[model samples]
Target: MASIVPAEKIDVIRRIEQLAVGAGLAAIVQTAIKLGIPDSFDDGSVTVDELAKSAQAEPGTLGRLMRALTVHGVFDEVEPGRYTHNDLSRYLREDAPIPIKYLVLWMGAAWTWEAWPRLTDAIRTGKAVIPDIYGKDFYSYLGAEGAAGMGDFMKAMTAITALSAAPIVDGFDLTGVGSVADIAGGQGRLLVELMERFPHVSGTLFDLETVVANADPKLLPGGALADRTTIVHGDLYDKVPVDVDLYILKNILDAPNQQSDRALLNIKESAKPGAKVVIIDALMDASVEELRVTTLVDLFLLLNVGGARHNTKEFEILFEKAGLKFLGIKPVPGTFPTQHLAEALVP
Candidate 1:
């Protein structure tokens, strides 16, 4: 084969094939997870018939699905017609620290998955395709879907936070910062973690009313963090509360529309002079693997919310426009996807 065709061309074709089948693989994985197939193997390697019965799936069909996933290294076919756990498949476990189950469910959601086919349309129209397909904005759809919908969304965010928050909390210097405010802080995960770590510093968790109402009770009223953390409900674009020394805009600025600028300005206005604003997000200009990840995320932002991941230079421009002084961007070491702590000072 190598003699007949150049290796480079063959590699290109292989990559295209992988990309083409990406959605199919995701669908299979999502289906298996939703069926609790991974949990069925907890006792050890199980035959196709046993596993299928446990997962409530057809034995032959589920066997084929498991074989395909095994080819992708999601599970181990220790012997013919039997499967067991692998590093990749274990993530589907219900109690995994970073439960990827929720992330998979959210990404495989109808509105989200359907929008990918309209990426070209979004590019042509210079708008997110979510509204065109779903007849409403992403957040509005989540709201209309009610508690179960929003809970899954929060679970996905919480999973991501579980991985990144520890690195972020330890990376920054929180000493002497009298108070901190986490804007659009979903489930108050980061704020709760920070307050627990730095008991000397008080913190406020700010987000939309519905989001705050669904925040983890362990972080709110009469809970572990209640004494040191105040959970407030409000839109980041409208107001971010005032008089906090540190304003954390972790995932806030990456929202669609002009919310980034408006929210940054709101934080600027709400902050006292010399307040520190830290943006915890993935920045461009990283290693090849990191760039690939961040670039994919930037595209997803376009598809989901009309936002794009930014580099330090782009953030400098945003801060300048929002009337804040750019301090610098610091990398949060020991993170999986690796994020930056972009710092700016309120003027």
Candidate 2:
């Protein structure tokens, strides 16, 4: 007979088991969102039959999926065979205020899902495998696939940027800054939020012409910013709005170190003396959780884009090399998502 496992080893075994089925768990959640199963519960408690009917799924199979998600707190079975929205499940609602449906969709998308298995190849080659695996770079594929898929990906990214923007706007001080440039500010979400917060601060929304062209309706919803915000279109490596007091490069450094250096140098050269270059990203650290998310994102950049996350030391080196002085780093508070604000100055 097999030897009985020790109690200490039991937790480890359980952890391993959990990790083993993690993908299936993620798939369950994704399916629930995709099927609009959570939408059925919005009115109140819903039977599996109702959820299945609404989602056009068979009752028995849908019930199994719901049961698996319930075990992981994605939904609550209030009564036998009936489900209701729990805290987690509510966010998957089709019209959730903080819509994560897109995130679920993107994460579970075929291309992204397929790339994970090639992680070892990426590490070995020190190059992105997405192009090799998918026959195109990620963005090119997204573009070629047409707007629907790209829109979903952009929506997911916008949701993530929205979550991070609040803590940043509240945490960082932006007083007396005459003008600001949000480099690669997609859809103008963060810049709009910041502009709303500081009415006196005129802003320039600098990004690709294509990106800015599609940014109407989502680029701050009022005339208040009409006079204050200018949507300037250009590549960051080539040019940014010069002489801006503050230039925000939120989550833009996820490139190969050399490319990041060139981009930083471009910004530094354009920036007037003593201007601030604020970089917002998850700076790598010693904490396990920090390492987990940041390193995975770093790997993601490596696999798809050619970018990587920077530790403080790495940022220090990048800043020094780019003709900018490291000003220090600040942590954005609130548990939604923690990212470090690395401030540097053009010398």
Top candidate by TM-score: 1
Compared with the true structure, all predictions reach lDDT values of 0.83, 0.79
lDDT of 2 by residue, 104-196 (tens): 887777776878788899888888887897688766677676767677777887788888777788866777688888887777778888888
Candidate 1, residues 192-261, lDDT tens digits: the string is 7888788798888888788988777877677877787787887777876656999988866777637888
> Which parts of model 2 are misplaced by more than 4 Å?
2-8, 216-224
Question: How good is model 1 by TM-score?
Answer: 0.94
TM-score of each predicted structure versus truth: 0.94, 0.91
Candidate 1: minimum summed lDDT over ten consecutive residues — where? 1-10
Tell me the deviation in Å of residue 217 in model 2.
2.4
Collision pairs in model 1: none
